[model samples]
Target chain A: MSYDFYMPVRVLGGESVVKTQAQRLREFGECCLIVTGGSGAKNSGALQDTQDALHSVGVAFEVFDRIEQNPQTETCRQAGEVARRCGADFLIGIGGGSALDATKAVAVFAANPELSADDIYKMQLSASPLPTVGIGTTAGTGSEVSGVSVLTDTKGVKHSIKGEQVYFKLVLADWRYTASCPYSVTVSTALDAFMHAAEGWLGPKCGEAPTAFAVMCLPILWKELKRMYKTQELPDSEQRKRLYHASLNAGFTLNQCGTLFPHQTGYILTEHYGVPHGRA
Target chain B: MSYDFYMPVRVLGGESVVKTQAQRLREFGECCLIVTGGSGAKNSGALQDTQDALHSVGVAFEVFDRIEQNPQTETCRQAGEVARRCGADFLIGIGGGSALDATKAVAVFAANPELSADDIYKMQLSASPLPTVGIGTTAGTGSEVSGVSVLTDTKGVKHSIKGEQVYFKLVLADWRYTASCPYSVTVSTALDAFMHAAEGWLGPKCGEAPTAFAVMCLPILWKELKRMYKTQELPDSEQRKRLYHASLNAGFTLNQCGTLFPHQTGYILTEHYGVPHGRA
Candidate 1:
């Protein structure tokens, strides 16, 4: 009967949107911290595209390439230190869920350097985090358009921080990043996107806006998933584009209504069974 | 293939949302100018609910109830002068499309008193306009959710001023307002909502978010339209609520993609042929 709605992030999608929208990165600041995983962003050429875009705009950037799966709090703190040392004014997260999630925490810790990682999970930040932009290299987590950041703590417990302050100011979704993903990785990630839309649609908190997002996303995801299952291969560029946009829609819906029991229960599968996040 | 998306306005719908959401109005301002048509808001009890809510919060307000169908520039200027004299800080638009449209213009002129009505249409104001809250008493026009204000000029031509600046910060939609609307008005307005969704879906400028909106809206509008045509009488409260929400969805879609040729060509039907906008 009652709900508050806002999806303030601007999402740009298509082939080469990252390069096309490079000029917009200047709005964040003059200097940037590019956060990525071990080899995903680099191998996929997403990092190069981002770097080239920043270079074209006359903006300088430093890369923090050590973000890991289910990004650890310690890793975020380490990345934040690098960002602080580089005097980076903004952050561009250029990999999958882990990098994007870690970037939000890193942006916060980088802005509030005096605070420890535990303090981030325990207390609300008084200071605004550095403006962060998401260059989504994968379509699974929908993290590019979400404000929620899940990071594993020192005790191996996963904790999440969420608020409007943590959302990326802009998102660049480039489907080419998924072109390099292993079939298992691609299926799992695409399933996660489907789960988000399904859960959001059935969730009690689901309202008109979120429902619209779910309705838009699920069909596209279903079509792409069907094609992927039939071909037993990676989708063509056009199909990937549909899947990419569908994932963004699901992420936006999740941002509004959140995931239901599956997300919480699925964590056990991820931690205990060594399942990939999307598979879990 | 490419798009920019934002529909940040919070829409509260149902029978008593104005009274239920009275406290939220405080976010707009303390002192307010309430704008409306001659009798729509009053006869529908929407004005009284608004007054009760403002009184509960101790917010002061003045009413300008002279807005006509296809709101005029001169009327808006006069209302702006009254608002200026009263030292109102924000505006509450509480009637149909014309009142809501006029309120947007009044807010702009009230903030920038130096500008003439012609100037309001001819040039964008350098300063931001007063914050506006819309309490939609009718289901058509979607003015409550849109930034475009269609105002008739001194030459009697309808000119629109549109931008993010004119968008309402909040919208309160009470189907009770449409409870009093004649079946013809209800059907016509509902048709207008349908046209927006259809046109937006088919438009060349349409993108993912707008297409999502059009998809969500068109079905609800069609169902409501079918019910109205069969009943040939005012709908029950539940039906009215569905129609109102559908109209708001249509308005949101229109805000995103805008109406293509039908809206522009339909203006002639409204202006010269005496057709209701939805029918046109």
Candidate 2:
């Protein structure tokens, strides 16, 4: 009958998310790192738009646009070096999980120079907490709201540093921003989200709060994952709203419950096939 | 998407709740105001036990032992003035929602000296927020985690100040304490939980989070409420946990999508008739 449930990742949902990036960014320190990959965020003008938002807020930033799919811990090491060199105090992970995952590790390393790619790979290092926020241009991963940052090692084995107690500081979920994702990427993320919702429900021995969170999120995601498979584009507004919230709830669910085996097992596509992390 | 949700009142579940009472009281204020009715918390030693917790934590206190069914605003104001004279910084609402509701208003009126019992009838006075926490003694109302306070005015008009925002700084929900609520109280509160789940499922503009909250809570409550009705008590630990979690999810649901007319209409029980707030 008694439990403490708190989500430090202040979640802001919907269309106005684009406009609030700057204000959200200001919640962290001024010097920032923008983690991105390929063309998604840049093409949607999301990358530039985010820079503009932070610029208006008077935050200085540097861009490490070399993040890649199934981000390797080495990429994280590089990003951290960039953050250190640029004196960035905070990170804005601006694409899908790859970019965000990269930023998450970079944040870990920005504070602890002694920890290398291998240390993070083994999840054996300790580092001071770093603030992170996300604006996903994709609907899958739910990375914008999760505490996990998955990366690959030089041996091509995948590793994850799960400091769930230290999750994102803010998550801005804008379905509209994700509308422009290619059909395949959208499908990949949607399936990943689908897996996350169901598995999250069955996986964790979570409390009433997180159990309630799963119940709320599952049906909506099941419905939207279907719709996304059909329309191959932005879902209807109602569905968009539904999926968007599902993503947030799913994030909250898995964040609390931890993911189930299917979700964990689903990551094979990334490790073996070079597919996006969301290819569940 | 821009919706705001916070339960500043921290919660500690299980027998451990007794251990936190003192620290919670000190955090609440230097002097504590205990609000309750039906003598259950007192009889069960929950009241004395909590006082012992607070005493160990070095907190001072007083009690309003006369809170009645439905919790009249008159009682609230009286308790408020008592709090004022006592210079209490925090209120501990023991027992069910009546005590919780009355305590909420008591804290409010104590904070805003200009308000009177009549102001509640007109819904005219704005009271400042004060710290509050609850010992659910009964599992109904979801009041422990919600930002609402309901009271009946002298003229038999029931009113609520939703966003009093501070009812308790910490909620101690010990299922063992819920063991003492009467059969009728159990039925009504469980229905209140069911109504919350049903309403949230179909509620206006609710998100995946609340939707998920409804789904997980509803099925468990539907089953548990029936069991409680048939047996007049939770028959086992599993059923007890189910009911306890359901009660919490019910509160979480209200925290997000707020109950529609049916639940809100229940407030009229205190206003239109003499039904105890719990029975109505």
Candidate 3:
């Protein structure tokens, strides 16, 4: 009976989605900042495609590749300063959860230079955050469509900055980008996507819309997980595409109902034990 | 595989939703216009609640109630002129499909005064349409969340003006508003909602998101539709609420997949044969 559905992100999925829909990026502004982790964007070929699209559309750009695993708030602040100094009008995030999540915080800082890194959690801003375009290279994070950004503070504690303001304005979901994931990373990210769907499905807040997304995604993730469990093999291209899209569906579920016990406890293992977020 | 999802309307649903969420109206601007059919808005008590909410928020307003069944382009143009003269910043649409559909066209005309009534179909505007708030008093149409507006042209031909431009900025869905519908209206509107779900379920364009919405709403609609066939009685308050919500779910489905044969042919019957849209 819960009929409150309100996700505003526009998602376009296909092969070479960025190339086909590059004109959409121009709507944000003439110049941009591209944010990513050290290697995922290059490894997945998303960086090349994003640059090509921007070049074709005649949009000037710069890259900030310092975001790490469990993104640090101070790092995001530095990237924001870079964007402001370069006069970048919008931000393009290309990578997994960490890089994309950092991009959200960077956008807030970029728009509000007066606020320090820690002030992001306080949620006080004189101006709205810069609009973000997310090009997700990994299948697990769902950060492309979600507003929740988990960032490590100066104390090394993980706190989330969440609200409608942080949601990406556009998401170019190309499953081809996920085909490059190594075996362990693939397994871990698949687990993360599965956990997202499972937690939302079991959560008290799961309503009609969230339940529909969960139902649509859980079976897809289950089939892939079962195959991987039996074979100990990396998914084929078709399976990779399915997994990537399933992760997006799971993201929609998680976006609506949010995470439950596992996510809360998983952060602890990630922070202290050097565990990857999904595996933890 | 079709992973394009982009509906931006924010929907809030529950009993007395308007009164509880009245403050949201203030975000649009200082002054507004309310558009509706003659009695549905008043009889449903949505008008009084809307007025009270607007007054409480200190947002000035005016009402235009001349819209009739299968809204005409000329009528909407006139309403837009009224809104322009009054200096209304935004528009609130209350009632069934006709009123809601007219409001969408009125929004376009209000922002583009130089364009004649027939020019709306051409989809040309120097500026974006005014933001719209849709309050549904009927279980059918789903116009609150959709961007397609079916308006009669100068030749009395029913052509649709569609795109993201016509989408409402916000939607307040109170099932209580639908409780006032009599037996015939209840039956017809329910059938219209059923047709939307069924058509989208069967359509070739029905993708994962649309199918999820179709699956969620189909059973609820089927149960009520079957009961109505056997009992031939009006639905109680609880049933009315269920039906109203089911229609919204169906609306989500229709908004994504759109209608096929029935909707195209049904308009002909409605325009020429004087048959009610749903029954046709």
Candidate 4:
């Protein structure tokens, strides 16, 4: 069997990993653009922690908080313009898949301002994207460790921009952020993580490494899901961490093998029915 | 629960994949240098096929076929000089571990001639190594998909040079090549591959992805080992392919988790007792 595997995104995860790991942001330049959806990053305290980390490192930063579910292509371009205006050297995406996905497109535009939204969808660009950091607040999507961006065009058609170019330079994931998430959001997102592993495990592109990721993740996620469903509350901190890392592992699998029919079909629900990105 | 994983190699397997995939060589550059050790490549017909593929694509290349087992630093430097003198833009490694390992070091020197052997060992290079393509002639050493080079110094002490710079851009693995390997060599190499999986599976650095690779490889290697031990002759071509791919999978595991005490201790047996690399 012949196959290909690659995942360049560096991930640091745990309870307080964001505080400890955010120091790596120094590897990117001096200024930063923090991207997030409505109130997720703020509510989770991830935004404050990230700001503190940047402040401690004496790096300048600006926050762009307009990202919405099923991030819009136009919003990403506007964020890119903000980054360019502020002379932001890098980007930090904090929140769920929408925020993280939007950051990738924003970085691409910030790096090449001449490129249009259509150019981005077409994937025509002259330079590499600015370095980006992803700090996930949700337990699914695994966007923190993926090089894929799902954005909706003005026509409400979802478009995916993928490849190595979109891979985040660093990913800081703290499981505690999901502790405050709503039950429905938590369960749906967790299910999305499950599907990533289950589908990837059975996919035609499955390889030894990806299967290992699946084997390791499926058990942890299943156990946590069972506990959450029975208790109707989030699992303990330890289990929460396990679920979060399991999602990251599944993301790594998807990075190599990619998803099959389910992901493609899920996109339709997300775009039309307004289903949450993870639930769809 | 958090670990970093990355493997950028694109692998193409099958009896004639080398010829089919060599067209990708043009992506690296105009001219190339083919690195090999002894007659392994010629005996397996891999070198001729590689040359024909390059010729068909009209890419100029030169052969530097003087690598020795347990590749030496001096020899690699010499090969690098040959590559630079020939104006080779990229490198094709076509043999067993020694040749593939040497190609990595040679590519390093060819790109930055100012650096010495000491600099390479210290990873004090000025620029990235040239792109590399690996073709395996042995079922052992998954060097085709890894960016690790184990070279011996003048003191006869084995030193390992590893980094992202050494990762092959493309890997062409064909099980048919190992069909020509002698019984002793084949068994030894296969055992070495087994050790890679076993040790990596048990290492402290072991992660989900690496464990998955080990899980897939261990069973295949075990079954093949039982058969090889039972009969003096090589297994059928199909089994050989399985064994070869298993070795590559083990290599992927080692690339992430790395080997432990066994690999460290095996070096001594190879250096002192003159045991073959895999047997030791």
* Candidate topping DockQ: 3
| Superposition TM-score, candidate 1 onto the true structure | 0.89
What is the alpha-carbon lDDT of model 4 when measured against the actual structure? 0.85
Best by TM-score: 3
Tens digit of per-residue lDDT, candidate 2, span B1-280: 3333333455667765677545646766688788888587776567878878877978888888889877888788888888889988878888877788788888877777787786754445565556776887766578887877777778776667775354466777777777665667667777777887677667775665566567777888788777777776644655555676677767877777777877666667656665554455
Chain B only, TM-score of each candidate: 0.95, 0.88, 0.98, 0.97
Which candidate has the top score in lDDT?
A: 3
Candidate scoring better on TM-score of 1 and 2? 1
Tens-digit lDDT string for candidate 3 (A1-280): 5667788998889898999999999888999999999699999999999999999999999999999999999999999999999999999999999999999999999999998889999989999999999999888888887879999999999999999899999999999899888888888998999999899889887777878888998999999989988999989988998999899889988988889989989999999998999999
Segments in model 3 whose C-alpha atoms lie over 4 Å from true places: none
The TM-score of predicted model 4 comes to: 0.94
lDDT for A23 (candidate 4): 66
Listing candidates in order, what is each one's chain A TM-score?
Answer: 0.96, 0.89, 0.99, 0.96
Off by over 4 Å in 4: none
TM-scores of the candidates are 0.89, 0.69, 0.96, 0.94
What's the distance in Å from true for residue B201, model 1? 1.2
Better model by TM-score, 1 or 3?
3
Q: If you assessed candidate 2 against the hidden native complex, which CAPRI class would it receive? A: acceptable
> Residue B3: error of model 4 in Å?
2.9
What is model 1's interface RMSD?
2.6
For candidate 2, the lDDT comes to: 0.72
